[model samples]
Target chain A: MDTVISAEDLTKKFGDFTAVDRISFEVFQGEIFGFLGANGAGKTTAMKMLTGLLRPTSGQAQVAGFDVYRQPELIKQHIGYMSQRFSLYEDLTVRENIEFYGGIYGLTFKEIRRKIPQLLHELGLLEVERQLVKSLPLGWKQRLAFSIALIHEPRIVFLDEPTGGVDPITRRQFWETIYQSAAMGVTIFVTTHYMDEAEYCHRVSMMAQGKIAALGPPKQLKQAFQAQSMDEIFLSIARGAK
Target chain B: MRTIFFILRKEFRQIFRHRVMLPMIFLMPIIQLLILSNAADFEVRNIYLHVVDRDLSPASRRLIGQFAASRHFVLTQTSFSAELGFRDLEANDADLVLEIPADFEKKLLRENEASLHLNVNAINATKAGLGQAYASAIIRDFNNNLRMEWLDMPDRQNPGRFDITHSFWFNPDLNYKAFMVPGILVMLVTLVGLFLAGINVVKEKEIGTIEQINVTPIHKSQFIVGKLLPFWIIANIELGMGLAFGKLVFHIPIAGSLWVVFGFAAIYLLVVLGMGLLISTVTETQQQSMFIAYFVLVVFIMMSGLFTPIESMPGWAQKVTWFNPIAYFVDVMRMVLLKGSGWYEIRQHVYAMLAMALAINTLAVLNYRKVGA
Candidate 1:
């Protein structure tokens, strides 16, 4: 696999506090890379620095063949970001949101018109295309947001807690969407607090207190930690963090 | 340009879709223009008067009759003591007290000159000043009449008093509403412009949509222009409606060409809306943006001289009005609507606003960050 994201001792500090400490990692193309951390474990911070949404205090990172700091605009053009807060204009109708996001990604009107029916048909959202996003259920909205983020069809897609607050059945279905994108040779960088979801990744890096405490395949990590499941592995690591 | 168009389309859709916002955007300004214009008048009338006549002679009685006859003053009471007249003034029953001294007719007949004292309520200073001028004029007219009748001076055909004939130019009737409607129209446009532009980007930030946009390849300048353009267009439309209401309802005359008024409004919106965008860039949430926008607007409106003349403010405050964008617009509207000032007459205000627009917009765009939240 080709290495798509390369980081060397990435760090970010806010005034006196360090949000993301000196941590380094690499992500290969067409692989599901899981970034697992607690609520304040700096997972989002590290992801921001890698995605060029934040400037690193020290060290350097290259994303999609562009430097994070010097070529942030270039990096932005090539990546799709679905933020933790579920970014979609709730007042806008489903079709309008698609058109807007598609437009912002430099998609032509013809291209967007061609993609809309296909996208809606694929997501089973064709029936409610004109309905406001605020009226949609939580599961459908999340699914639509994810699809909209991928509408640009960039090489890499970053999902920040994309399945948060959804039902377990919907979460399982959401994983299927992720697997489908990965099968299409799109690199996936996902951050989640769920241990079971972490098992779905090809490789996982666990962060604690602004630093990565462990990095390996989920199976190997569980085996190395002498834990029966990913949950125990995370619990044991979290215990050691204290 | 395409990106800006996309953003602009999205903004317009959102604004039109909001139920509460749609009504507020139109009705609030209309209501304010029709209703508040009436309440904001500064014309003083129906002054209450209490007269204390110490002399029972015909001269003093005739003098009292002159004040009673004038339409501006209403003789509310008659008092024998100056103390009681002062008490009525302090109690808010009377605005002025006319006190004639004892032996006033005897002094006027023998010595040929007599003086009367006037005690005026000065709490509302402008009202007091106008009332005093009316009283003094009536007294002067009375003195002239007495000189012509009692003195029998055919040789001195002209009285020695310097007859200063007052001529009011524009707004000759001094209709306060005419002076206020134009300034109020400017306020209506600004309220729409500043508050809308101020909260727009910050609302996106609060909702986490701004983070999504920040990671896009869209340029900051494109975003700033896109954000400001929608509100700019809406505010101008609001200004037009307000001006129409001012004309039809309040009967305000538009002296200068309508194009000149709109031209000034367009440039002035750039400055005010740019400041609003600047506020949004630094603020993280809509609430913060509202507070900062309101604080700046209060200072702006007070210094704008919409209700009070900027010249009447102290030196430092007047100097500060030179930087206020609202002040320039208010001045332009008044000069054009009341004085029929053309573009050449308002060229200085236009140039000042252009410089302000450029400086404020450049700084706002520079301060907007694509990264680091």
Candidate 2:
């Protein structure tokens, strides 16, 4: 398979402190790659560097065939990012939010108009299309946010803990959306603390103290560590780091 | 170009959708412009005077009559003892006390000179000073009249008197509202543009939406221009509303071309809104942005020559006004509204505003970063 993202010795330093230490990894085309870490393991920092939202202090990385240091703008054009906060304009209506994101990605007015009904129908939000986002339930908002993030049809989509605070059933439903997107040959790079979600990823990388502790498929990682489940694998790795 | 339009459209939708913000934007400025213009008037009138006449002669009676006849002075009390007038001054009932010496007419005819004690209460310095000036002017006019009558000149109307006629131009009646309404309109527009633009970006940061936008492919200049243009349009609309209120309610004449006022305003708002965006870039929280904008705006408005004339300010203080964007607008507003000044008369102010608009917007654009550190 073709490689969509590749990084070597990626590091980020703020003053005297290093946030993301020499972490290295590669993401393949149409593959669901899970980036796992405990809190403060520099997962978000690494994600930022990958999406061109931030620059690395000393590293060699490429995203969508563009260098992160020199061609960040080009990298930005090819990737979609959804933060842990579920980035959607809470004040705007659902239809307006879709059009806004579509427009920001260079879609014309006529194009946005054509895409709106289809997007609302796909998200099962046709009835509430005119409703303000702030009035929607958390589950609906999260689903809408995911759909809007993918509006530009970028080469890769990054989900930074896309399901942070939600019921299990909604989260399971959200995973189905990710699976479908991945099935359509859209690469998914996601970060999560939920072990069950990690098991769903084709491959998972566990980060500890700004370093990659493990990288492999869930079953392979479980068998190699002699653990029964992904939770035990993460706990053992975290304890070993300490 | 298309990206900027989308941003602008989104911003307009968000601003109008906010229920509380919508009314506050339109109503607050109109109400403030109406009420504050009346309060901002510097015209002082109705000085209360306590007169103590020691001389019961006709001369002393004539002087007291003159003070009573003057429109500015209200004869609050008449007393024989200076102590009574001094007591009135202490009670804040009287602004000034006029004491005529005994035999004041006898001394004026015999010695050709007579002095009277004018005791003034210096509390509320501006009122007291103005009261004293009005009192002195009445007395001088009375002296001139008495000289003409006493000399018994053949030509009573032309008694070698040099009449220095005071002519008030522009606002012939010296209406304070005409002067302050335009300045207030400028202030309201500046405030709306500055504070609104300042709070907008910081609010996005606080709510974590900025990260989503930063990851998009939009250019920084396109983003800044998009954010600024909507507010610029809203502020100008508010200015139009204020101008209508000034004209219909206050009857302030628009002496110059209305287009000139609008042209200056369009450019001036760029500087003010750019200041707001610049403050937002430096601050992480909306509260911090509010405080910083408040601090800078207070300094700017106070020195903007809105109520006080810049010519009356000290040389050093006046020099500092050259850098204040609000000062330029206030100057332009007054010149265009009251003096009917055309482009040629107000070109210096326009040039200053253009330079400020360029410098401030450029600095703000440079300071705003689409990427995180």
Estimate every model's Cα lDDT from 0 to 1: 0.90, 0.90
Q: Write the per-residue lDDT of candidate 2 for residues B1-373, one digit (tens) a residue.
A: 9999899999999999899998889999989987898888776678899998888888778888999998888999988999999999999989999998887888877776688889999988788888888889988877766766776654446757566889999989899999899998988998899899999989888999989999999999988888888889999999999999999999998999999999999989999998999999999998999999999989988998986678989999999999999999988998998899999998998899889889988888889987777
- lDDT for B117 (candidate 2): 85
lDDT score, candidate 1, position B223: 88
- Which CAPRI category fits model 1? medium
Clashing pairs in 2: none
The TM-score measured for candidate 2 stands at 0.95
- Please, what is the TM-score per model? 0.96, 0.95
Rate residue B262 of model 1 by lDDT: 92
State the fnat of model 2.
Answer: 0.86
- Report lDDT (Cα) of residue B167, candidate 1: 79
Q: Give the clashing pairs for model 1.
A: none
